[model samples]
Target: MRANLKTANLKSGDLPGDVTHHPYDAYGLPLMVEPASPALAKDPLAVQSWFAEHHRTLEALLPTYGGVVLRGFAIPDTMAFNAMIQCYDTDPNGYAGGLTPRKNIAGKVFEASRVPADQKIILHQEMGYLPSFPKMVAFYCLKPSETGGCTTIGDMRRFQKQIPANLLDAVHERGVLYRRNYRAPGPVSDPLVALFRREWTDVLQVETVEQAEEACRAVGCEAVWEDDGSLSMRYRSSGFVNHSVTGEEVWFAQVQGMHFNQARLAQNYDTLNKAFPGGRPRPIEILFGDGGDIPEDMVTPLYDILDRLAVNLPYEHGDFMLLDNIYTAHGRQPFTGSRDVQVGLVF
Candidate 1:
């Protein structure tokens, strides 16, 4: 990562981050600042200019501080909607296509999420599958859970502090292999759709047991299976590559390597079955299985550290949250009440 990625900007209105006490940000969290008004807020067209104005100062201030947080910068409803749909286009998870879900990638559609009922969501990183994903992420909570839907933030840099270098080196030598029985509807293809990319890669097709196997094998993972129809695999979490931006060594044992290879707990799915009247939940089913480093005994200990290190904040209204799709992981806990939220995805 660049030593400084955000440039600081001067405030138009007298506020806390005025010339006297400029706020600081470390990993881009506290970047949120109260704009004088929505009009002064950065427009998409002028957004680039606004960024250019502040990126340097923000980056410099962030290191000594943690991050920044702005209140009035909440995007308009129309703009928010557009941004989220665009998020779908970005395909941050490296799932091939951005908009197409199971059709282009493998994802389950849950019949129910927090919109209708109060549910407890477990904490996990989103799309922990890809390696060089996102660094600083954001979240805009349209509606918070009525009761216990409090978002938590965990710092992964801190988590890295606890990981033993030797253990990290081991995964680097032999990649981490992940197995998921996860499946979702086929990709949403444009019967008359044409697309282009910066680089040429395989056109992602429907996810299947075969791809699951290939996902493991492609990463040089050793596969294992049980007669009763269970899979266990291990692979090197990293490839011999360099950070495209920083030209840094992509270490295998790093979080990028360990992420997304979650041994998705089959129990997580089974629990959803009981929650649903028909013994199954649609979207919840999309995300079946538990995927994290396994060995049962070692699971909690590792996650305990992962939980503390990663930025795992709860959702809130006006929070157009974004994250490094590859680096940060996110999941939702069940919620209740008359809650409505729009999810926008952009590249």
Candidate 2:
């Protein structure tokens, strides 16, 4: 194992089995962890020990690095991956009221978003729009895509700096309001039903609309029943937040991800336009806290900044990545073939 002068004091014993760290020159110096010894890569127990020995140093590096990619570990299955995560954080968060459609694998581990491979998910902090969110998010690659399924990450600090100063000030002063419409599932012949396959019951995990409303209220959202028995909810949240450890201001909202103009929502628009002669309202919308429309001109520049700052991290089978949720924003690139990634959250 090579000695790291910065973390030399934190070293416990001669690092087990030749693990190596590589630093990247992105917005934050993101680290890449790899095994130098082939035998070490195949042994989950040895990797777990290595992580435990350097736990303190890893925690300290997170604020500066934003995240780390642990490759060549050959984590065998969900059980082994969960074991590795427990080394850093024992408390795993369950996926409740999560926007994406995912199935739990074991304990708190889940299949990553089941969105179509052709869709490109926009960059945003994980569940940043919610009243509560995990402090850290980790992804384990069980199977890598044959082509184009890189997980793109953006440094929140850099994104904050790159955006327009006036827009940033406006968001800070007014915050943001998120609106979502959930319709009931029905025959595909119905346009609205086809558009939003997810029903309110599925999202709230409740049998009744009253229970759904109560659940919304618990999460600080205002819920109203539409004339067609659909549920509409609005949540107000800050566009920026302070990093839990460093207290640095970070761009932490779902503006780009939920915005209609973004590529991620392009398919929704197409479906809606085809169903209705006139355009249908966006299922999700982001507005200024005062309910004022966020100018498209302002949003355009932020998208540009995100594009400029994003770093694409392609996955290899058995690769694992841990991200400081407040410091980094993540997304997915459009891919072909099968891509199986699992996620676990640390709260």
Candidate 3:
């Protein structure tokens, strides 16, 4: 432990300079750290220096709190955000076989997600479907939308504790299977198809089916090429994962989002269902590890659980947040106007 700094239960005026700490909510979700003085708030370099000195303390707190929010510092741009994370001396992680549409914008930084503004991104641990995933995920907000674009977070350990014992047992016994079908290269005529579909090349960051298969295999997924030029990949993973540092079992799966539950898809479900046969040709399908159908009854309860525990964090320009990927689940809320958030993954 660093001298004069404690890992847990940090409070205002505990650290040097004008920086102070406070709980974002009753849950202590993103232990909000900010400069109490106006001069320090405007000086990005000062904020950077402070973070560099106390990063280890923040790191220690992650397993307990799941995330930390650095507010009031005007971080300026993506490059600065990259610099802040680099203060911890972690290398930039690549997003290979990623599902969301995002473009790399700066060194080790990418636009958060390219989904339509009105769409609600369901809560899930980043890259939870993969065999290996980042230990930490950082998000920097360049701009907040005019309305309703909060980046939501949920504590997975809390969620795991709240999940009914029978449901937890079922998850542990059956595990989870995620199947993704990347569309063949072509223009999609249907708006619904356009919203849900991604080309294999876009997902794997490769031009050839062979390369895509190799990439999928590297990540413990079984890949197959369909005659129609579509690509399908399947992966089996435990519905719960143990936290890397704390060794606590936590809810760490994307089943709800990948399943595209009726509550989430709403009226679009019927249209999408009709557009794609058996919904097999859609972006992805989530099922039991044995390839059994995941009934709505099993998945809907999770939505309710997450909703009850969610912390809808409204972003301010220059706000940066770091999440312990294994301990936290994050999502996006629908919004209007311009919203720009960049993300970085670190192990």
Tell me, by TM-score, which candidate is best. 3
Against the reference, the lDDT scores of all candidates come to 0.37, 0.73, 0.78
What TM-score does each of the candidates earn? 0.51, 0.87, 0.90
**lDDT: which is higher, 1 or 3?**
3
lDDT per residue as tens, model 1, 75-189: 5443553443332333333433211232221121111122224443344443333333334334445566565454444333344456555545445555444332222233324
lDDT of candidate 2 over 148-231, digit per residue (tens) = 998888888878777787788898999998877777644456757554546777777778777888888766678877776777
lDDT of 1 at 272: 39
Worst 10 residues of 3 by lDDT: 1-10
Name the regions of candidate 3 deviating beyond 4 angstroms. 1-18, 37-39, 88-93, 187-191, 279-281
Best by lDDT: 3
TM-score of 1: 0.51
Q: TM-score of the candidate numbered 3? A: 0.90
